[model samples]
Target: MNLKFIKRNIFPLVKIISTVLITSAIGLESWNIYAFLTNRNVPSSLNPIFWIERFAMTSHFIESIIAAFYAHSGKKMPIQYATYTFFVGTIGLLELFDQEND
Candidate 1:
């Protein structure tokens, strides 16, 4: 088996899948929020769960903004990134192939 070729090709697939998963999650969440906004029967946005989610998302947004600034300075991340915990499995590629930057 050609391990090197498979190794080289796997990350792009992982990235594309991760991105799709993340996008779908966001899309689903948007639909939820839209339903809440449009239907008075839905729970209030001020619910504790919503506040907790808001804080979590805000923290993640801050990290991405920082990472974007770092990217602008031509310094790549020293570690791998994943959009969600499910995607973290893809980080194994870093250890398997020594691709820590990008």
Candidate 2:
């Protein structure tokens, strides 16, 4: 059980786990919105559609944070790091648009 070998194996595992968790969170958030719309009445003051959009955007923000962490873990190749960084930037832009609408 060399410490270096353990680290080498664990870090990539962590990145994969992080990516899966982020994707799951996005899916769950979307499902929540769908459930709200299909089964319940919408509130008059806050539009359910807009609220769902904002919630989805917030989930993207969380996904961006996960991507940033995975990128900074220093376990991935340069290309992988760049790819995660690009996702983070795209999520941030979506969040900004959501904020502007609210």
Best-fitting candidate, scored by lDDT: 2
Worst 10 residues of 1 by lDDT: 78-87
Each model's C-alpha lDDT? 0.49, 0.54
Predicted candidate 2 versus true structure: per-residue lDDT over 1-102, tens digit per residue: 796675478645755665675566566557667878889654555557556656655755665555545543444444554446343444333333444455
| Residues 1-102, model 1: lDDT tens digits | 486776679756865775575455566568667887987444565467555545545554555444434442343442333133233233333433353243
Model 2 collision count = 0
- Clashes per candidate (backbone, < 3 Å): 0, 0
Give Cα distance to truth, residue 55, candidate 1, Å: 9.9
Q: Which ranges in model 2 have alpha carbons more than 4 Å from their true place?
A: 1-7, 40-102
